[model samples]
Target: MRAALKWVLWDVKDTLLKVRFSVGEQYCREAERIGLNLKPVEVNSAFRQTYKSYSSRYPNYGIAQGLNGHSWWTGVVQDTFSLCGVQDPALLQTVSHNLYHNFCNAQNWEVFDDSKKVLEACSSLGLKQGVVSNFDKRLEAILKSCDLLSHFSFLMTSEAAGVAKPSSLIFEQALHNCEVSATQVAHVGDHYINDYLASRSIGIHGFLLDRDNKYNQSGIVPKEHCLNSLEELPSRLQEQMD
Candidate 1:
């Protein structure tokens, strides 16, 4: 005797979608041209580490009393480069941000093949769809730019929801907006802890999407059901409906 499914919330970023950046060694060549010994791997790693740390802390420092206003990703790029021994922090910061901006909204970011095909199938079958992300204000613009914003009925952002994931409030807000109860929803995200564990705590069914199967979140049942791609979701849901 299992529960029926009704609401479904999906994570953005690496779950249902992935974004591309810097074509044909653009930035690596540019960094060298600027007289900095930078490799694509170094820049990529630095940017990613910086983004993760700052995005995690953003809402905590954002707009609180006496908290100075700033962008987290900007700080991430700046601080990461500084740690790597860059002297001209401002110039490098500016260039890096421009590079990251170009990356974020570029025609490069896209929904995965598995996600798109499954979503189209699910939508055709009328699954309530919503999106939740631990992100800043640019979410709407990014989604719209990528032609993905309209597919969702609800979008919960860290900035907009006044909190990030692992906080049930944001998930609750998403539930309210989507008109779905926790018992009936499923959330999919790349991170095991935030996307899967948090949703599980909210009494919702959850999915941990591991494309490479590189990471696994503890305490989930039926690992086979924890998909490697969204392609399996439709058939999986059909199994449930059976």
Candidate 2:
């Protein structure tokens, strides 16, 4: 029999909140203003490539020893611009700063339609809720601004934990803070590795939210474990309990 779930841990980006603006489009627009012409497609490709390389090398480097959110994001932005062939140190700094700060504003993001409903449903079920994300300190303010802060009892960030998801350390910290064992917790998020598999690896139930139906073609997850929306979560959890 499955243990009764006492808490639900969540990932922020692409899970509960979706950024309203495109990062690549914003970057290209900023570049054009600075006399640097960049195509959104090319800039996005370069940014993804740079991000993948950094994530591979550092593997949760945001909270890795001695790195804070600003420094980590600055490095990512700088590398993104550099890869896009912007070699001027002054220009790189300017664009990176612009990109980083732009994300700090809540207006740039929107909560998913299903997010609030699911949170309400879970709350009605008497489940404690909290955030476990690879984000930085600014997350608290973002959540507050987005009206989501009240739903969560605690907000754990990469900056606070000094480690990102897919590492058991952050998940362990959440369990410790909630005073619950892994079996009593379940995590919901969009990422297959960082959110679902990572939590499941440590005995926490993991639900993969595939809102776009993109993972339907990927056979890595069982149909029962995959959800098309957060609206399905409460019922799914109830099924497990029964």
Candidate 3:
């Protein structure tokens, strides 16, 4: 029989908390506040392109290349604005810095509607929780700002773990921190490969939060493990323990 679940590891981004505004909108807002003019649509598109390029070039904040989280994200921000026609070096620096620090504020993030209720339900069930996210160092402040910090016993970021999801090392580290066998834990995340498969590979139960039904027809995730909302989770855990 599967071991009783003692813990529920969480993925922060897109799982519990999401940015309150589009990157383009937030970036344009910050720039315009400082007297610069830019189109939200253009800035948003540029950011997506730049972010994808940066992720491909520097996976996990490019730690292997001696780049830390701040430097890596700053590069992405600067390049994104540059692509959107912000040519003045001083202006780029100013906006990039503002945008970077702005993300750490509570105004930039929102907790999912169901997150607190599910967390409370799990807590009532006597289970501990921790964060295992592919996020940078700003995660704690962001979580705190969203008032979600008290729910977790620990926070593990890619910056701290020196590894990111889809890599077993971070999950291994979470397992160690929990001091429990893999079978006694479960992970919930929105990403298919990163949160679900990665944890399952090491024996932790995996639950995919398919809020958009993106994977419903993918034929990849098992039907039992796919969840449409956080509300379904406490019951799932109860079923597992039975």
lDDT scores in order: 0.70, 0.86, 0.92
Give per-residue lDDT, candidate 3, residue 181. Answer: 96
Question: In model 2, where do residues sit more than 4 Å from their true spots?
Answer: 33-35, 62-65, 214-219, 240-242
* Ten contiguous residues minimizing lDDT sum, candidate 3: 214-223
How close to the true structure is residue 162 of candidate 2, measured as C-alpha lDDT?
80
Which tens-of-lDDT digit does each residue in 10-68 have in candidate 1? 88888766666543244555456557776667767766777577556655436443232
Candidate 1, poorest ten consecutive residues by summed lDDT = 61-70
lDDT of 3 by residue, 127-186 (tens): 999999998999999988888899999999999999999999999999999999999999
Candidate 2, residue 115: the lDDT equals 86
Span of ten consecutive residues with least summed lDDT in model 2:
58-67
- Per-residue lDDT, model 1, residue 108, is 62
RMSD of each: 3.8, 2.5, 1.2
Model 2 Cα lDDT, one tens digit per residue, 159-217: 78888788999999999999988988989999999998999999999999998887755
Tell me the TM-score of each prediction against the true structure.
Answer: 0.78, 0.86, 0.96
